[model samples]
Each structure stands twice: as C-alpha cells, then as structure tokens.
Target chain A: MEKFDKLTGIAAPLDLINVDTDMIIPKQFLKTIKRSGLGVNLFDEMRYDDDRNEIPDFVLNKPQYRDAQIIVAGDNFGCGSSREHAPWAIKDFGISCVIAPSFADIFYNNCFKNGILPIALPQEQINVLMKDAQKGSNARMEIDLEAQTITTSDGEVFTFDVDAFKKHCLMNGLDDIGLTMEKAASIDTFEAAAAQSRPWV
Target chain B: MSPKTLYDKIWDAHVAHEAEDGTCLLYIDRHLVHEVTSPQAFEGLRMAGRKVHAPDKTIAVPDHNVPTTLDRANAATMTEDSRIQVEALDKNAKDFGIHYYPVSDVRQGIVHIVGPEQGWTLPGMTVVCGDSHTATHGAFGSLAHGIGTSEVEHVLATQTLIQRKGKNMKVEITGKLAPGVTAKDITLSVIGKTGTAGGTGYVIEYCGEAIRDLSMEGRMTVCNMAIEGGARAGLIAPDEKTFAYVMGRPHAPKGAQWEAAMNWWKTLYSDDDAHWDKVVTIKGEDIAPVVTWGTSPEDVLPITANVPAADSFTGGKVDAAKRSLEYMGLTAGMPLSDIKIDTVFIGSCTNGRIEDLRAAAAILKGKKIKDGMRAMVVPGSGLVRAQAEEEGLADIFIEAGFEWRMAGCSMCLAMNPDQLAPGERCAATSNRNFEGRQGRGGRTHLMSPAMAAAAAVTGHLTDVRDLM
Candidate 1:
C-alpha cells in the first residue's frame, strides 16, 4: 500500500451525484487480473465516444483536468458495487483524494485501503472546493493528512475528520493483512473456540 | 443486559478482537468467491506468498464474465477478456485449495446462489463475498455483506475482517401483501421510499407479518437489494422456513449438530423493544407492483404511475432526475405502462431462483410473448435451471416465445454475451437499473418476474395484474 501524507496537485470538479463504481471504471474494464495499468480505462464510457475517441466535454477529458490528482465530486459518490477496482482505477489515474458531500460506505472504505483519501464534507464545503477546482491547473490544493486539513489555492482551508486507526494506517503505509497477522494468536484462539462450539462450521 | 438488535447479536458473536477505537477483527465463517473481483485478490495472495487461512471456509465459482450459452465450455467462443477471467478463477481455486465449481460443473452458478443452496451461509455466521449482492445470504439470519478486493485478500490470508459497528435499522412491513404483489415489489418499494443512501451506515433488519410470511426464496429476493439501498447488508430473522430450506443441503449439518444449530438459530431475532437507530414501517397493501423508470434503483414508481418530471425532485436530486430521464429516454408525464421494451431478462442473483421462474411461468402459460419481443429466462443456478425444467416451467417459457437458457448471471450485467445492444430498453427482473447496466446505452427497468412477464407478453410495461 502507498503511504498518503501531504500532497499538492491539481483538483478537478465532477459535480454529479451518484457517480457509481460502474461509471468510474465500468464492468468491461474489470476483467484485468492486475491492479496496475487501469488508469487508461478510468471512466472509459464517459471519457470515450463510440469511436473510442476522447470526449473532450467530460471532466477528466478536459485539457487542464487531464492530470487531476484530486476530485471534488457531488453527494453519494461511489454509490454502487463493492468493486475495489473503482479506487484502484482512481489511484492509477493519479487522483489521490476525493472530496464529496457523502459516500457509500463500502467505496469510502475501499478508497482508504487503496491509499486514496475520501473526505466527506458538508455540501457547502464541497461547493467551495468544487469552485476552486474549476480554476483549471492553477488551483492546486494541498491536503495535509497529519493536520487533517485541505488548503485551497486561494489560502482557504477546511478541516476534515477521519477514523483514527485508518488515518494511522494511511500515513504509515501499513498493509492491513500484515497488521492483522500481528494478532494471529488471538485469531487462533477464536477459531478454536468457534470450532468447539459449532463443530459443523 | 440490554436488548440487542438482530444485527448487533450477529456482529457481537463474530467479533474475534476489538480495539478501543471500536474497530474489531471480525471472524468470517464463509467467503464466497467469483471470477472478476477475485483474480486480483488471489494475485495479491500469490504476490505476498501468503497461504489461505481457512481454505475449507471459502467457495469459488465463475459467473459474471462467462457466456451463459452452450459455448461456455468452449473458451475459444468467449471474448478474450471473459475467458481469461474465468480461467483465472479455476487456477486460483486450485492453488488455494478452496472448494470450487468450475464452469463445466453443473453445480456452478452465481456465487451467492451457490452459497445458500449449499448451506454454507447459515444463521449466526459472518459471510463475506467479493460481490455486493452477498447480502442475499443475510436472509438466513447471518451478518453477511460485501467486501472489496483488499478485504477479500485479507480474509483469504487471515480468515478475519476488520470492521466497525454500523447502526441498526428496522424496516417493518405490516399488512398482508395484496394479491399479485410479491417480495420484489416490497423491496423495490422500500428503496423507493428510502432513496439510495438511505441505509448508509446502518445494517437493516427486516421484520413484520409481511416479511415473516414470505418463503425462504422470497426473503432472499428482498435481502438481495440491500446494496442497492446503500446498506452493506440486510437481515431477516430465521424461522422454520429458513431451517427447512437449509436441512439436508450438501453442506448443512446433520444429526445432533442440526439440533444444536437450530437452538442457536432460534435466538437470531431482535429482542422485543430492542433499540433501533431508525425504524421504517411499510404497509404491504400499499406496495403495488413497481418498476424503476430511471438509472438509480430509488427512481421507482408503482406500475400505475406516470413518469415524474425532473422538477419534482428538489436539491441535488433535480439534476440527477433530469440526467436519468435523458438517459432512460423517458418523457415526463408519460404513463409507465405505455413504455415499450426490446427485451425481458429473468435472471441474476436477485431474481433467478426457481420460485421466481415459477412466478413468470404462471403468467406466460398457454400464451406467447408479444410479436417481435425477445425474452429470456436465465436461472440463478444450474440446479434452479434443472428444477424449472422438471416443473415444466421451461416448457412454458419456450412455448411462450421466451428463450429458456442455461443458468448464470446472464443479462443482469453486460459482462456476459447475453447483453442489450446500444439504445436497447429492457424490463429486467434484476436488481440494478443503472445506466448501461445490461449493456452500453442499455436502459433497464427493474421489476419482479411476473411484472417482467407482463411486459414481455404485452410488448410494453403492462401491470401484471392487468394480464391476470
């Protein structure tokens, strides 16, 4: 897992509600076994036309937003599907932070697992960030995970809350499997008790 | 001691270790695996050189990316992408020593269908799958939910999941269902009232006369849409019907073990007066046969309603409704029954059980689908397909001009070859109505089996009761 800390990069505005996982990478692109190399197919249908030509009107396809590392999106972003590929594609596309009014629980957790910061702010705060993001490449937002704040290009700053343990893991690049393994003895005890109590399982 | 909700009891029973921060290492009793989301998780396992923690607890099948036709056995006939994904699952299962149902195996089908059918998903257990619809098994009184690939690999490696407690919600359905209304209608109506994201941060427990009256299959149908309602899982208290459905299954306990299991399962319901974060009551009589008219599952209306104007939605919803209307090709004020469809899909983890097949067949018996309409019934599993055939339901579908096909998650998703072409409109028995869910530019209207049959026979969205 990649460690997430303070990052300064261009932010893009995608003001659409219910931007589901299928819209992020679509089911067709989900066939890949490897997590790498999915950035090119991120938002495939929305970014491409019938002829596979780039649709310039789409936010990610726009000239200045092409290299966006942060996304200021609408409410309930990543609403459908438990596909981790959604966050995999987002990170692969160089976006490390997503600011939304709210998010579906699964997608929000998956984002943290993939080292993509999903910040749920009030819609008004999201509106502020969305406006700053529309300032093209010049609007580079600085997110300080340690400080728990996002600073816009114009010096406006907003604080966001994240779970303490999840925040610790993100800052340290701690792999969850490795962290869980440290408690293997406890797991073994639980399993033994479960086996004796419910032998059929 | 405080009374615990159904979700709280199941969640507490599975907690292996809890940190002061409220994060708990949840013990997972069952892990359902599939082709698409799992390949990367298995690869992660191989990359890390970690062995599976409990191979026997895991089960695998290929469904999403496989062709539902006879050519499934011939990999050459499938798209390269689809073939590779399915092939990868076969290898992963073998390498991990997991119980598997290969594509060529008659037992093979959608993972969720296979799990409950095998009794691998039981009451008082914690079930996790790589797919969102794993919530289907919660009908058995388990705490089941979907996990991402990272968590999939975590479960494979540790047999435990990291989870925090979610709020508890009670959706109480009162009154007996009206004639012709089904569990699918009840679920769709629930989502329609709650809207998408209404169940976020809550594990919803469904109870009441209407819910308890449903058969095991009907309960599964309602629980299957929990994800679409933005809840990670949904639960129904186990009863004699649930026990009867599980008894004598391939993986179910027998003899003394069965008695012990039942003793615990009988206590799976929420205690009377258990505290609830939220409580929603729905009168079953008010739930008419419904269908989704827009992209989101929440954009549903009773069969008799007209297309809602975008302006009818307020706040951030207005633009979403407008976009959905544009994408679905629906005109404001248009009667829902007047909408025409190019296809009728009767399958998916959501509505592909044998009971679902029988419901559709009842309507199509001694009748034919509309002229120029194409309809297909892809059962949830191979066993479901066989049972439908044995019951003469398949014959009814075939005689009615509906294609009776092999089982898999056929047209509910576009990954399979059974897909809608661009600009095609469909009346689907599947859960999702998201744009391009069946295929690119494909518009889906979610409904029950009988409702889908009605649309098929009438060449439009006719109320199933009208046909009756």
Candidate 2:
C-alpha cells in the first residue's frame, strides 16, 4: 500500500448522491478478480453515450475537470451494493480524496484501505468545498492526511474527525491483517498454549 | 461495573487475545468465500506454500460473476476469461478441501443466503466473508462482517482475525409498525433519517417492541443495512425467535448439544442495566414507504413527498441536488408520483427474500404491467426462487408480464448483461440508484418490492399503499 502524505489536484464535483458501486465500476467489469484496469471503465455508462462515445455533458468528460484528483460530491456518496471495486476504481482513476457529507459504510472503509481519504464533513462545510470544486478542474484543493485537514486554494481549512484506530492504521498503512502481524509473537504464544492444553495440534 | 451488552458478551467470548496496539485477535468460527474476491487470497496462500488451517470452518460459492439465468446450465459456457476465474476458485477450494457449493449444486446461491439457510450461521459464532453483506449473519447474534482479500487469505491460513473494538449504538424502535409497513421500510427510513453514515464506527444493537415483533427474516433485513448506515455490524438479542430459526438445520447442534447451545444462546442479550455509547429512538409510525429521489440512499422521502427544492439546503447542496435532478431528468418540486419509469426490478440481498417476493406477488395478482414498461423479478437465492415458484408467486409475476428469472444478483449492479439502457429510468427494489447504477446514464428510483410492482403496473412511481 502506498503512503498518503498530501493530495493536491483539480477538484471534480460529481454533485450526485448515492453514487453506488455499479456506477463506479459497472457489474460487467467485475468479471475479473484483478483490481487494476477498472479505472478506464469507471462510470462507463454515464461517461459514454449510445454510440459508446464520450458524453460531453457528463461531469467526467468536461475538459476542465478531466484530470481531477479530488472529488467533491454530494451526501451519501457511495451507497448501495457493497462493492470494494468502487473505491479501487476511484483510486486507480487518480482520485486520492473524496469529500462528501456522508458515505455508505463499506465503501467508506474501502476507501481508507485503498489509500483514498474519504472526508465526512458537515453539509455546511461540504457546500463550500463543492463550490470550490466547480471552479473548473484546475481549481486545486489540498488535503493533508497527517494534519487531518483539508484546505482550499482560497485559504479555507476544514477539520474532520477520524477514528483513532483507523487513523493509526492509515498513517502506517496497516490493515486488519497487517495489524495482526504486528502481534505475531503474542499469537504464537496463545496457539502454543491452546495446543498444549488440548493436544489437538 | 458495566452490565454486559450483547456485543460485549459476544466480543468477550470470541477474543483469542489482545495485541499491544489494543486490537483483539478474534477466533472466527466460519469464513464464507465467493468467486470475485477469494481467488487472489487463495493464490497468496499457495505462493506461501500454506495449507488451510481449518477447511471445515470455510465454505465457498460462486455468485457475482455467474449469469443469473444460466448459472446452472452455463456454468461451463462462461467466457474464456470468466471460465478461468471460476475454474480457479473451484480448484482452489478443492485443493484446500473447503466445502465448495458450485453452480451445479442445488444449494448454490448468494453466499450469505446459503450460509444461514444451511444452518452454518449459528448463534455464538463469529463469521467473516469477503462480501460486505456478510453482516446478514448477525441476525443470528453472531459477529459477522466483511474482510479484504488479504484478510481472506489470512483467515484461510489461520482462522483468526485482528479486529478493533467499536462503540456500541443502541437504536430502539419504540412503537408498533403500522400495517403495510415492513422491516424494509423501517431500515430505509432509518437510512434516510441517519444520512447513510450515521452509524460509522459503531455496532448497532436493534431493540424495542417493534424489533421484537419482527420475524427472523425481518431482523436479517434490519441488520443487512447496518453496513449501509456505516456500522461495522448490527445485531438483535438472541431470544426464542433466534433459537427456533436455527434449530434442526444441518449445521446446527442436535440432541444434547442442541439443548446446551440453547442454554448458552439465551444469555446473549443486553442486561436491563447495560449502558450504550449512543442511543437513538424512532417511532415506527413515523416511517413511511421510502423512495430515493436522488442518487444517494439518504436522498429519500416518503412516496407522497415532492422532490426537494434547491433552496431547501445550504451551501452547494442545492446546486448539487439541482445537478443530480438534471442528470436524472427530474424537475424540482415535481411530485414523486409524476416520475415515470421505464423498468422495475424486484430483487437483491437487500429485498430478495421469500417475504419480499410474496409482497410483490400480492400487488401483481390479476394486474398487468403497464405497456412500454419492462419489469424483472430476480430472486436473491435459488432457494428463494424455488420457494416462490412452489408458492405460485412466479405465475403471478409472469402473468403480469414481468420476467421471472433464475436467482443471482441480477440487474442489481448491471452485471451479467442485465442492465438498463442509457438514459432509461427504473423503479428498483435493490439498494441503489446512483447515476447509471442500472446502466450508463440510467436513472434509478429506489423503492420496496411491492412498490416496484406497483410502479410496473402504473408506469410511474405510484405509492404501493394506493394499489393496496
């Protein structure tokens, strides 16, 4: 897993709520187990038209927001169907931070796992960020994972709270299993004790 | 001293050890696997030359990539690419000696459904899966949750997981649910009120008079949305209802063991004096037939409510809602009843159960789907599909011009050629309606199964109560 220090890029405003897994990476793309290669088809249906051509009206196709690395979206940004692929595709597409009023449970955790910073902000704060995001793709926003703050180009700072344990894991790139391995010695001791008592090993 | 909550009791019993970082090593009793995420984990195991530590505790099934209609017949006819993926899962499970319910097995369906139906999800167990809906097993008073592929491999090699403790949230429903209201409605209303992320970093314990009245299936539906509300898991106290639901299943205890297990399960509840980190209350009568007007699940209102105006919210929320309405081709202040639909889908893990099907069938009997509207009924599991057929509900759907298809996650995510055409709008029973959740540029209106059926007959978002 890559380490996250800071993310500064163009802000793209999807402005839609409940943007679910299917829209992030349609079900057909789920045929393969490989997590990579899905970014190209992220939002495939909306990104293209009946002729499979880029729909110029879609937010992703707007020339100014084409290279957006930060997504400022509406509330409940990743709801419906628990597919980790949604975060995987978003991360692979170069989106490192997602600022929303809320996110679906699974997709929010998956974002942290995949090195994306999903910031859950109050609706009032999110409104400001979304406006900043609409200033075209070049409207650069900065996110400092260490400081746990997001700043806009206009010098506005927003601080959000994260779970202490999750924050530790993200800072050190430790997942559940990685956290376990950190205590490999203690686990070995317990296994040895259980084996001796039961003689099943 | 703190009185024991159901979560505390379960967590204490399952703890194998506590690490230096304060994360506990949990002993997992069951691990469920599916085709989409398990292959990489299996490969990781083989690379390390490791054998499964407890094959009997693990089970595998194929669902996500398998075509719902031909899951049985076309198990061998998969595209060359998918064929290899499916074959890899089969071989991996075989080599590890884990129980594999392949497509050919009559028992095959969604992994979560198969586990509980087969009695593998018993009380006092900790279940893990690579799929998030794994929380469905918590209906049995177990600690069930989704894990990543790496953790899947780790559990395969060692049936244990490192988990951080979460705060306890008690969501109590105080009043009786009115007739025509179901567990789906309650959960949808909760999501709408809680803003989808309301339960983050907590284990939600459902209680109160209304929750106790719900059947085990209804309880499962409530817990199923725990993930949607940002909770690690949701649980109900184990009572006679929980015990009766599990007794006599193939995987459940029998004889003296059954009696002993029952005694243990009886103690799995929060004491009268137990304290919770957070408590939220909702009156059942306040909930209505919820329908998502925007892309998010939280973007919902009662079926009779109008689309929210842009000025209703502060900041850019108004503009964002406006943009979503434009993409969805809906106008502000338009009555939800005025939105016409091109398709209707009534199935998924969320609402694809026997009761959900029965609900839909009741509304569709002797009724015809409106012209120019296509409706599809996909059961969540093969077992559900068979039971619906046996109950003659399939006939009602077919007679109503709705497609009666085999079971899998069909049209839920637009996988397996089941998708809405670009710009098409659908009234879907499944969980979401994000932009293109059904297909590219496809618009979705999330509703209950019965509501979806009503929309199919009306060609518009009509309240199910109106049809009732």
Candidate 3:
C-alpha cells in the first residue's frame, strides 16, 4: 500500500454514469494476477477499437488528458461487480484519486485498500469539479486527504467524508491484513474458544 | 439484553474481536474461491510470504473464464489467458494445501452453488468470496458477502476479515405467489422497488409467508440477487428446509454431529422482539413474471407492461433511462411482449440449478424454439448437468432446438466463447443486464428460467403465464 497525502495533478473528466467495473476493466483483461500490467487495458473496450487503435474521443485517449492523475466522473461510478481489478486498473493508470457524486460500496472500500483515494462529493460540487477538470493539461487539481479538501486550479474547494479508520489506514499505508495481525493474540484465543463451542462450523 | 435481528445474531456469532473504531474481526468459516478473482489474491499472499491460515476451511473451484463446450474438455483447450488464470488457481490451491475441484472433477461448479450443494455453507457461518454473487450462500442463514481481492488475501492470510457491522433491513413479503410467478419474480420485483443502490450499507433479512413457503433452491435464487439490490448479503432463517438440504451431503455432519448441528441451526432465527434499521413489505401477489428492460437490474417491469418513456422520468433518471433505451434499441411505450429477442440463455449462478433447469425444461418439452432464434441451457454444476440428464431434461431441451452444454458459467458474461454477437438481443436467466455484459453491443433481458423458455418459444419477451 502507498500512503495517500497531498497530490496535485491534471484531472480528467469522464461524464458517464454508472460506470461499472466491467467498463473500467473488462473481464477479459482481468486474467493476470499481477496488478502492474492492467493500466494499458484499463477500459479496454471503451478505449480501443477493433484494430486495437485508441478511440480518439475517449477521455484518456485525448492528448491533453492522456497523463491525467485524477478523474472527475459521473454518479454511481463503479456500480456493478466487486472486482478489485477496477481499482487496480485505475491506480495502475496513475489516477491517484477519483472524485464522484457517489460510488458503489465495494469499489469505494477497495480504493482505500489499493491506495487510491475515492472522494464522494455532492453532485453540485462534482459539477463544479467536472467543469474545472475539462481544462485538461494546462490546469491542475490539488487534493489533501489529511485535510479532506479538493482545490481546483481556479481556487474552488470541496470537502468530502471518509471513515476515520479508513482515513488512518490510507494515511499510514496500512492494509487490513496488517491491521488484523495487530490483534493476533485475540484471534488465537477466540479461535481456541470457538473450536470448543462451535466446532462443527 | 436486546433482541437481535437475524443479521445481528449471525454477525455477533462470528465476531473474533471488536475494535474501538467499530471494526470487527469476523472469523470466516468458509472461503469460496473461483478462477477469475483468486489469482491476484494468491499473488498478494505470495508477495507477502503468507500461507493460508486455515486451508481446510477454503474451497476452490474454477468456473469463470473456463470453456464449457464439450470439445474444450481440459484447461489446455481453453484460451491462453483463461487457461493461465485457471492454472494459477489450481497451482495456488495445491501449494496452499487447500481443497480444489478442477474442471475434470464432477464436483466443479459455480462457487456459490457448489458451497451449498456440498454442504460447505452451513447455518450461522461467515462465508466470503471474491465474486459479488457470494450472497447466494446467505440463503443458508449465513453471513456471507463478496470481498475485494485484497480482502480475499486478508482472509487467506488470517482466516478473518476486518468488517464494520452492516445496517439491518427486514424485507417481509406476505401472501402467496401467483401460479406463474416464482422466486425470481419476487426478487426482481424487490430490486425494482429498492433500485440498485437501495440496499447499500444494509444486510437484508427476508421473512414472511411467501419466503417461508419457497423451497431451498427457490430461497437461494432470491438471496443470490441481494447484491443487485446493493446489499452486501441477504439472510433467511434456518428451518427444516435448510436442514433437509444439508443432511446427507458430503460435508454435512452425520449421526451425533448432525443432531448437535441441528440443535444450533434451529436456534439461529431472530427473536420475536428483534430490531431492524428498516423494514419493507411487499405483497407476493403483486409480483408477476418480471424482466429488466434496462441495463441495471433495478430497471425492471412486469412483462405485461409497456416500456416507460424517458421523458416521463425526472432529473438524472430521465437521462439514464433514455441512454438505456438507446442501448437496448427499444422505444418508450413499446409493449415488453412485442420486443423480439435473438437468443435465450438459461443458465448462471442466479438460476442454473437442477430446479431452474427443470422449470425451463417443462416449458420446452415437446416444443421447438422459435424460428431463427438461438437458445442454450447450461447447468450450474457438473452434478446439476448429470442430474438434469438423468431426469431427461436435457433431452427435452435438445429436442426443442436448444443447445445442451456442459456445466459452467456460460453466457453469464463474455469471458468465454458462449456469448451473443454484436447487436444481438437475449432473454437471459442471469443476474446482470449491464451494458455489453454478455458481449459487445449485446442486449440482455434479465428473467427467470420459465420466462426465458417462454421467450425462446415465442421469439420475444412473452409472459410465462400466457404459455401456461
């Protein structure tokens, strides 16, 4: 896990709603267990044509937005499927943060686990950010996870809510396995007791 | 002491420890692994130099991305990428000392179906899988949910998950289902009401007369789509139906152990004074043969109704409906029954069991598929396939101009060779209707096995009641 703190980068605007995990990274591209190679195939179907040519109109393919490190997307982003590959692809593509009106629950949680900041903001706030993001390469968006604020190039600011525990983990680059191992003694005791009482299960 | 809802009861029973920040270490009793999602988790485990903490508790099966055709009998015959994923899982399971069911094994099936069928999913347990449809195991009164690959790795390394308690919801459906209606219809109706995001942050416990009256298989069908309603899991109290299904299975206890398990399972229900964060009630009689007309599962309507106009909706909903209608190649106000389909897919984790196949077979018996229509029946498991053949259901489907394929998740999504071509329309017995889910530019209508059979026979979205 990588620590998420303050980041300033060009933001890309993707205005499609209910952008599901399948659209983020189609199932066909999810074959590799390694997370490193997925960036190229992120949104493979939507990003490429039959001849494997980049679709010129896709937000990521546009020359100005090709190096975007942030995404201002539509509501209900990552709505279907629980593939963590969606976040893996997004992070692998170098998009450190995703700002949307809302997100599917699993995807929202997975982002933190994968070291990507998923910021849920009001639709009005997203509208302002989306417009700001359309500025592409010339403009940069600043996000401070510790401050819970996103600042635009023109000085507009928005705040978002995240779970306190999740915030601490993201700041420290701690994964759940590391957290669980912190209470290994408690786990051992509970398992021993459970074996005596609920052995069959 | 406060009375606990079914969700709370099962959740509390599984808590290994509770954190000050509201996180709980939930000890998972069973871990279901599939080919598509386990590879990365395994890679993470390898990278971290960790081994599975409880190998005996995990069951691995390769279903997704495997070729289900008869000619592609082995992994070598599958596409290079698919074979690699499946091979990685096989190797990982072997290396980790976990039990695995390969494609050559008759026990190999969809993880959700295989868990219950093999009795690995017992009452009052916690089950997790990397697949969203893991909620299907909640039918057995277990607290089961789909986890991200990272959490899958966490569970493998620790045999526990750090989870916050989910809000509780009681969705009580009273009255009996009408003759032509089934559990699939009830679930679709529920998703339609709740919308895709309605059950977010909640674990729904389904109760009431209609639910109690359903068979175990039907209950599984209803619980399987809890994720479609944005719920992490759905629960049903354990009863004789659950006990009956569990008894005599490979992993189920016998003799003294069975009696002891039965006593605990009987006590797994919510008390009369149980509390829930929310309660929703729908009359079972109100449900009909339902089908999703749009991309999301929540975009459903009764088969007898006409498509709703996008302009009739408000705000962002209007745009969404219009976009969906455009992708589906449908017009507002068009009768659902009038929308012709190009194919019918009768299989998936949602409705690919023996009972589901029997329902479709009854409708297809002595009847041929509509002219120029393509239809196929893929059972959920190899055991289910054998059972269907034993019952001559496969013969009926084959005689009716339908392809009888081997057991695997065929046409549920486009990972394998079984998929719709561009611009093709299908009546699918699968869970999702997401854009290009079946194939690029493919359109899907989510419905029950009987409804899909009816559509196959009529060449469109026909109500099963009309066929009856």
Best by lDDT: 1
Lowest-scoring 10 consecutive residues by lDDT in candidate 1 chain B?
B68-77
DockQ of 1: 0.82
Across A6-38, the per-residue lDDT of candidate 3 in tens digits comes to 999999999877788888988777777677778
Model 2: iRMSD? 4.3
Model 2, B1-468: lDDT tens digits are 679889888888767787567767787778999888788778767777878877988999877666666444855545666667778888988898999888777677778778888888887678889877787888888888877666687788768875778888899987898766788787778778776668877888889889999988888888877876777688888788888888888788788677767777888889888879989899987878878888766678988999887678765457667767887888888999999999999987778888889999999999999998888998877888899989999999999999888777668776656888877999987766666667777888888888888899999998888889
Model 3 root-mean-square deviation: 1.5
List, residue by residue over B54-82, the lDDT tens digit for candidate 3. 99999999998878788777556688888
Residues B1-468, candidate 1, lDDT per residue (tens digit)?
799998989988888999999999999999999998899889888889999999999999998987787666777768888888988998999988999998788888888899998889888889999989999999999999999999999999999999999999999999799988999999999999998899999999999999999999999999999888899999999999999999999999999999999888898889898999999999988999999999999998999999999999988889999999999999999999999989999989989998999999999999989999989989888888888889999899999998877778878877878888888999999998887888899999999999999999989998999878
Best candidate, TM-score: 1
List the candidate 1 regions with Cα displacement exceeding 4 Å: none
Q: Which candidate is the best by DockQ?
A: 1
Chain A TM-score values, per prediction: 0.98, 0.88, 0.96
**Model 3 segments beyond 4 Å from truth?**
B74-76
